[model samples]
Target: MKEKNLLKDSSAYYENNDYYEIFSKAEDGESKVVNYLSKIAKDKIVLDAGCGTGKFLQILEDVSSKYIGIDLSFNQLVKAKIKSRKENSIFVNTNLKDTMLCSDSIDLIVSPWVLGTITDLGDRELCLQDLKRVLKPGGKIILIENEEDSEFETLRGHDKDTRTKDYNNWILNNGFKVMERFNTYFKFDSKDEARKCFLEIYGVEVASRVKSELIEHKIVLFEFVK
Candidate 1:
């Protein structure tokens, strides 16, 4: 696969909620990403852009006064709604590039593993602009993206999302700062389950590399204060 195509392919997989939910369940089983977000998101109005399956909603809802989860996929949103527990939770089927939200409304925005899949640089910029439009002054936007040379990246057979130099440069030029680099893993109940899950989500080529139940994933966190 070409470096650029991997993200597009991965993004398409989310349209199928069944496979996507399974993939989401197997990822970051240790709550590394959630733990990191909890420290920064307390008592704020949080928007989870491209929330998909609401994997982080439970934790995000626990911290935010009001929580909004938006995605372009209604099927994904349907799955997200099932995971929502609090009265403050809202799920919207909307695109990130143009969310019809009030100006200067949100206190924090979380875009996890979502923007890089946009593929078009122009669209990514538009998405950022819209995110800025809704963000309160001094409010923060946090992004979680794949970092280079992870075992997961090797399996994907490409480096676009994982290689941070160019991606990080684009983010920096847009006024975001690197917050941290961390390690997480996709943990499965068994090697057989891992193989089956990877095969369904990543295809046979990538799935063939699943030698164990735990696959190391490295990610970088970016923060923008508007």
Candidate 2:
């Protein structure tokens, strides 16, 4: 799908209470991410790329000196605006492939499940390049991507297992060092329950078959520093 159409469809697709409830259940994931970041330092500017509904931004509120969120979905940004009323928090609608943020100005960048949606490998690379350009030297990047060997097959989209691995390597090659890697598994009681939850968050018919396979699947959390 074209990027604009995909963003519009996704915004309309997730405008339901069921989707928000399922997403709220996953808020613990944000906590886990925040805990990991807390060890880094307190005095730093942070950016949450693809900050869907601003769930993770809440976790970073008390930790960072400044927090900014950027996403492509207008609907998601509206939700984020409602949740973040802090003066230091800002949300912008911009694509990661081309950002207006100043170069080498940010101290840390966090992107949970953001990279997986870019269906084009070239665009993914450009996104990474843009991220690198915007990060200061020795700055950290915490990212999470669906695990290749996991049961979540449909989430893989046109980008295959090799592509994800290549993207990981690209981060290292561009000027970042891999500091840590964590593999997390998400569980559901059964295929029906899993399907219900995913449909609510990601829209129905997007990953029905994959939901069945992802009854227990893995995601990778990567901590890197430039």
Q: What TM-score goes with each of the models?
A: 0.91, 0.72
Q: List the residue pairs that clash in candidate 1.
A: none
- Tell me the tens digit of each residue's lDDT in model 1 across 92-206: 8887888999999999999988888787888889999999999999999998887777888887765644345577678878899989888899888898888878777667877
lDDT of 2: 0.65
Best by TM-score: 1
- The window of 10 residues in a row where model 2 has the poorest summed lDDT is 1-10
TM-score of 2: 0.72
Worst 10 residues of 1 by lDDT: 1-10
- Cα lDDT for residue 167, candidate 2: 62
Question: Each prediction's Cα RMSD?
Answer: 2.4, 4.8
